[model samples]
Target: MTSTHADAHILVSMTYASRANPNVSATDFNEILQQAQINNAANSITGMLTFNKDYFLQTIEGPRAQINRLLYILISDERHHDLQIIDTRELKHREWAKWSMNYASPTEENAAIYLKYSTTIGFNPYLLNAESAHGLMNELSAQKG
Candidate 1:
């Protein structure tokens, strides 16, 4: 069934671990980001991704079913496993409207926010706050020719 958000957007924070696949590397990650952008452009979905070591934290926003379907595909993909739902909320506006997936390499600054949320949610925050999390993404965009 198709689901739509009339006055708000559904936000989902999820955590997953890579499957130790030999094919899964930084380049593969970049390709995933490109694919996400294509999908988001067509669907008007938005989100961000943060990675620390082998753990991944992501937030997706869109129609409820669309976001859930995307998450399902991500969690079910063979390249990742141990999928966990960290948090979910309804937002009045789209936080990452311009990008389908903003990617960040986790660092000390970002970890602070991730740790705080992790403590509150009883799970390790694989993702940082949207504010700090976007720094890496901005850097990535700057490097693109």
Candidate 2:
């Protein structure tokens, strides 16, 4: 017996972090966000992206195949490098189902929220536990509202 995309019905969530390419301009980041929202919504994916000047942290949930395809795209994208997957899990329901790709960039108003999830004042997803990473996104989402 073999499993295929049709046979894989489980929803999965993936959390990852990457160092942003220094040369990537605001226009480039906006384009990436726009593309991700369009692609994710079309594929029934939902997620949140958080970034600072130096890094990107994101959590995405969807069908296994779509998530895998996203991972592949992330690996090949030149806008960022040193991609690291922080966690992957089979999900019962999406944490951010309402968002195709909600985005957040740290501001002074929310700096404390980032600090709550990080060991230091700066936001660093690599240092975060899976639980904290999701918690951080949830908090950020609340702030967005």
Each model's C-alpha lDDT? 0.59, 0.88
Q: Candidate 1: what lDDT? A: 0.59
Q: Show how many residue pairs clash in every candidate, following the order shown.
A: 0, 0
Residues 43-140, candidate 1: write the lDDT tens digits.
Answer: 66887766544566666777666776787788777766676665566666776776777666645555544454453543233344444334444443
TM-score of each: 0.63, 0.92
Minimum summed lDDT over a 10-residue window in model 1 is located at 12-21
Q: List the residue pairs that clash in candidate 1.
A: none
Q: How good is model 2 by TM-score?
A: 0.92
Predicted structure 1, TM vs. truth: 0.63
Best by lDDT: 2
Collision pairs in model 2: none
